[model samples]
Target: MRIGKQNQAFTAIATSDSETITVRGLDLCDDLIGKINFTDYFWLLVLGDKPTEAQRDMMDACLVAIAEHGLVPSVQAARMTLAAGPDAWQGAMSAGLLGMGSVVAGSSEAAGRYLAEVIAKAEADGTDIETAAIASLQDHKINKRKVAGLGHPQHSGGDPRADRLLAIADELGVSGRYIETLRILGKHAPGIIERPLPINVSGAIPACILDAGWPLEAIKAVPLLARAAGLSAHLFEEAQRSIGFIMSHKADEAIAYDGKTSSRNTKAAE
Candidate 1:
């Protein structure tokens, strides 16, 4: 197949029956030359677009933000769950991904949709969204009693990553009213903590992604990819520390236990 056309920095042209990835007309195994961050490489592969410097920075921060949570259930689960044997990475990753299923992780996309609906309605109603969001927060407060953004488990009082993401949003001219709402809420909430209970990275990223015209599920996929990255890193360290231990452990073949072990979280399927 012979083809040639281009969009982003490099163009791809099918030349010959190649053995591996042939970027452009040159053999990736030989002629390809460049230095790029994982974010850039990831973007190029998945998005087929070289992310801008700003985009790369935001993506990088987001990736690092979720990498490791210091024995958060996921980390511990991965360790204990995967001590089972040679295919440890699979089990560890499964456990790590399991933690991402929490409300804290799932809430952002829900909140994003909430804001999106509110904004669309507000805009369509001949009213500004900021004013409407504020009003909605106040009027809906008694009934719903939910904050659009603020307060995090890890940050306790606030998340610094939220601020970093907001800066990127501003530079990118992305919709960040949700962020402003978080900030305003943090400052004014009764007896606000020292850290101000700022929104975590998840909350803001959904907004950023929404503004970028992506589905909520898309933002979620990003974290999974990043979590996999984190898992690899964790497994590398874990394997190095105890190769023998990892190899020695094995799953007890289909135990008929009436209860769960601290290490075994499995339950009887309904």
Candidate 2:
């Protein structure tokens, strides 16, 4: 029954006695309940401190921007899981969360890391941020790796959410090196990548939040948290309208099987 470490379970996040609950050393009821919103509370939970007003606003904007992109794959997965087992709401939610990987809601983290790399290289080389950004884009192009968070298929002109978040960052005076780097990348991407790869919301999120002092490592948390709210809404609607199986049926109708005939089909042919 022993695990990696015996008699040494520990968590700095929170603890509670019968009389009180604490989160990151703050009294949950007394210090947090009405004094902070969920986004600020989330920052406290992750980074062990409340966010500045700019940080909170930037975070809130990113959260709102990413939440509820309707019927995305993760939402579809969650709805379908719920349809299969109507009683297991937890399972449905789990299905949705599990589907958020590198290609989907998880791209924010990758974009954040890439931005950080550009900033670091610029700092190290004593060149301007724009130069470093273009160089980084060139590297990605050379390697045939995707420049994460650059383009949106649906928003070919540009991502409105991304523009709004960056504007909010500027209004709040939190727009800094990362945000500048992101803009530089966007400016140069068409020339370097040979296409108009405008900055998407995923890219904007990390740039703004990172400039606001969020840890780059935790950038994915922003989207995951936002999508959880979206998924909850979806699952609730699925329960009410029962569309999980309808989505499944739509998928069946959308795709044509292009393989060897099934046994029944082959028998019919014969």
Candidate 3:
């Protein structure tokens, strides 16, 4: 039996024939291959239109800012997967991508949604953005919920990448309500959250990109695409100077076992 009601598949992304290929209604070879950068192509593929100069620059900056993070857990997982099965590079990449959950590389999407919510609440209540942000932060504090994209254990003083991204957004003149919301959070977060939780890269990424008109639903795609580039590099190195097994060995050495003893005397156990 058929699975669903639809009789034919549909996609506006691309199509190919004997002589030519089209992407978002543009000729791939003649119009895009040599003319557009990957970041612009990415924008066309996702939003079905090319990005403005500011949007493209902001996107490129974010992609570069998040691309590699020096053997983060996801990188380690990818490396270890490669070590377990040296020939399966795709499997290793999948393992790495799978590790990007709420706590790791995926935090950008969460922050984007939070920023959107604050903006929406302010618009609904006819209040200023800062007031709305403060209220949302206070609510998170009371509920013991994390205000996503506001802290980094390693960058306690501040995250340089975040600082740089925000600066670029400001310089490009793309800073908007979301960026303002993020800055307001940074300013008042200590008072509400009771800690100096500065704006992290995750926060900066969404703020800048959203101001540049990226959809909230696809916020995660930015980091995912960027990390894929990083993962490819890690996998390439794994093929040559393999460290997957080394990481596994270190993990084994680091974790201590503290289980129950065998049910017998020492001589019997021996």
Candidate 4:
């Protein structure tokens, strides 16, 4: 069966021939390989153009901020996978990346969408961003929904990474409407939700990157790319020290089987 939308048989991202490779209209070897850094290359690859100094800086900062967050579930999963296989690094990486869902590295994309919705609500209601933020947050509260990017389980006081990224965005003069909306949400979300919901790095990332001209669709890419590096490190360590089995054993010890008792066990006990 056909999918929802018609697929276009083309990709403007890259092309290759016998002689040379081209990416975003630049020769990969001649014009881009050494001339451009990975951050700039990432921007070009995604947005079809090179990043400005501020964009590059903002992107770089975000990447660094989210790259390695100690033994997050994804990292744990990757490390464990590597320990199990011992040779299949690619599979291990895939295991890690596959876990980057809405609750993990992908939360930035949700936060970006949340910010965009606030902007849209403001424009629609003919109110300021702050008012729109309040209304949207209230709606979320009424529906008993969690606002993305507003809280961190580990950093209840506040996410330091979030603070740093927003500060960086301000320094780069990219703390525009999206960042404004994010701040408004941060200010109001706690009061509406009747709890402390300070912004986290996930929230900060979307606000900074969206304000810095990144598309909302690609917000998740930042964390994914950064976590790839983190996963590599964990996988290397797991290979050397062999903690995958240790983690598996720890998990086994931690979780108790609370399901229905077996019939054989009941008969034997009787």
Q: Find the candidate with the highest lDDT and give its number.
A: 3
Clashing pairs in 4: none
Kindly list the per-residue Cα lDDT of model 4 for residues 1-270, writing each as its tens digit. Answer: 987877877999999999989998999999998898999999999999998999999999999998898887898899888887888999999999999999988989988998898899889989999988898889999999999889878788899999999999999999999989988899998899999899999999989988899988888789999999988888888888888888889999999999999999899999
Better of 3 and 4 by TM-score: 4
Cα lDDT over the full model 4 = 0.91
Per-candidate TM equals 0.65, 0.92, 0.94, 0.95
Residue 213 alpha-carbon offset, candidate 1, angstroms: 7.1
In candidate 2, which residue ranges exceed 4 Å CA deviation? Answer: 1-10, 262-264
Off by over 4 Å in 1: 1-36, 104-106, 143-148, 154-156, 168-197, 208-217, 242-270
> What alpha-carbon RMSD in Å does predicted model 4 have with respect to the real structure?
1.6
Model-by-model lDDT, in order? 0.60, 0.91, 0.94, 0.91
Q: Cα RMSD (Å) per model?
A: 8.9, 2.2, 1.9, 1.6
Sort the predicted structures by TM-score, highest score first.
Answer: 4, 3, 2, 1
> If both were scored by lDDT, which would come out higher, candidate 1 or candidate 2?
2
lDDT of 3 by residue, 7-98 (tens): 76799999999999999999999999999999999999999999999999999999999999998999999999999999999999999999
Which stretches in model 3 have alpha-carbon errors above 4 Å?
1-9, 264-270
In the range 76-108, model 2's lDDT, one tens digit per residue, is 999999999999999999999999998898999
lDDT of 1 at 111: 62
Clashes of 3: 0
What is the alpha-carbon lDDT for the whole of candidate 1?
0.60
